[model samples]
Target: MSLDTPERLPASLADYQALAQANLSPDVAAYFLRGAGAEQTLRANAEDLAALRPWPRACKDLRGGSTACAVLGLSLDAPLLVAPMAYLPLLDPAGEAGVAAAATAQGVGMVLSAQSAQPMDHVRAEGSNCGWMQLYWLGGRDATMQLAQRAARAGFSALVLTVDAPVHGIRDAELSAGFALPPGLRAVNLDGLAQPQFAPLTSGESLLFDRVAHVLPGWEDVAWLCRNAPLPVLLKGILHPDDARQAVQAGAAGVIVSNHGGRVLDGAPSSISALPAVVAAVGGAVPVLMDGGIRRGVDVFRALALGADAVLIGRPVCHGLAVAGALGASHVLRLLLDELEVTMALTGCRTLSDITRDCLGPSPF
Candidate 1:
């Protein structure tokens, strides 16, 4: 019933959610758990993924099979990575450092959020494996470039530029709960940068259009970052095929099909629903990754069958972290990987490459 009860262990990823909710304050839980608006897209992410059925095979040679793969030239034990989530210190005292340690222990990569509660260098030092830094536009090019360069200096291997959320989503749950960061914990990585200031809006003018939209990054900015960044830039939050193509044209190293975990744009398509088209758009020019509603290992297989070269997990790992810090987070990953291997064995997929669209049947939906 409590985080200190180490004897009780979560048997499935879903179990961690309840455990986490129990461990966290009600307001904090709402902040971490809710999606934008009506949460239609949030529910759809899992629902649409469940609609696809795996075409199970009875027998195969089943020899020399492995889940190992590589993304952006970095080898991985499985096609899994931790999606960047901000303010981990709110979940546990160990914070992002614990998550990084957990990812390292599991032989997967961790993408540290620009809004991370821990300093980038300290978190990177906790993990020896691949680490990526997720970047938000930070109002303009100079500040953004400074953060990217800091990640490079901290030993991060790549940069994941989140392009979808130009402004924060209308998260009803967070608003209702009145969520605010507790004192002494903040986005330490963003310290010393001047926050963007906007001119006062005149009455009857659109606040979003008139004041906020001007600072948003554009295609030219993506190209600029790709050309100048010390690390390879992967554009996350891509859903539309045209945008995917544009990302590749902008010289991106990869594209991540995400709706910002359904935390942005309530009616937007789930990452799973959008993956196939994004994959086709890029046409293998760059790796295509996705993150949304990945609750089980079978979901990971389903994503691969659709087109994602790899997948990132967000809330479930946080759930684990809330329950028992690094050990719980690592256990969540281990459970998923074990389930993925089992699903592969049943579907006759010996390696990640073997998990093709053929491994799937028509959607039950």
Candidate 2:
């Protein structure tokens, strides 16, 4: 499948995934597509969403429908954003810059990854709608703050602190594939910053518990970043309802209900299954966003029905990038948005506000 021209683009998001599977190197595919442990949670993310059914409304006035919405003060064409993914250069030489351009051209938001292969300023310059920067606590507050300050100076509108997976997950597929970044491709945004160091492990000590855990960010760190960072901060990778409440109390601007796209904990519940609880916990105090297993426009509608202010997509965009650089990425968003509009029309929803829980029927799960 040569996806060199726009005319050759796939018709649906699933097709894009197939194209990506056919196109990407096996190592890259395994790294990007697989999840942690037995992949129980990975499969659940999509399967749970598939179990849900949307109740179609018949013969209602369908006029002036629009998917436009606001999140963290940024107006978006659709309640959609490209979730951050690292080292896009592996898929195409254009890399994060290409994804940024696609997001900007589509009038959707994008969150630049902390491990981006392209410089923050270069991506920002390429994407006017690129408003958020996703951050991982780089061992401590000061080192992490430096990245936050850099993002602010580059014109990003928000900071998304990924609080889950203080360490990398046990990804069996990635290990089997021997995934390693190709030569010359690196996290350009992290340049010049000192990497985190830990005391040498001693015999009979757990490496993760004795050494790595010492540098993990806690509630205090979250509060400090919220209070001191240059931009509004939103905590990503939250699943517990209590954590959602804690994030708000810590002065976070918002909360993203995610399970690290089911890549962190194999048995964790799907993002959709946990969303209503988190939303209830938030109690309208802040915006609630979601990610994981959002492959169709109907999934977006399903999320909004359950109380997600917006949704982000990770693998689908990467699949598109792997297929045809910026064009494939942009086409993927277009297909989803177009499908969202059609779904809205069929469900008798004229606006985003019209999508409520009543629009949903019983889920098989």
TM-score against native, each model = 0.96, 0.97
lDDT of each: 0.90, 0.91
Question: What RMSD value applies to candidate 2?
Answer: 1.5
| Candidate 2 TM-score, C-alpha based | 0.97
Predicted structure 1, TM vs. truth: 0.96
Give Cα distance to truth, residue 269, candidate 1, Å.
Answer: 0.6
Scanning candidate 1 in windows of ten residues, the lowest lDDT window is: 1-10
Each prediction's RMSD to truth: 1.7, 1.5
lDDT (tens digit, per residue) of candidate 2 on 1-365: 45667676688999999989988788999889889999999889898888778899999898777899888888999999999888998998878889999998998999999999999999988887888999988888888999999999999999999988877788999999899988888888888876667776666658758677777888988999999999999999999999999999999999999998878888999999999999999999999999999999999999999999999998999988998888889889999999999999999999999999999987655
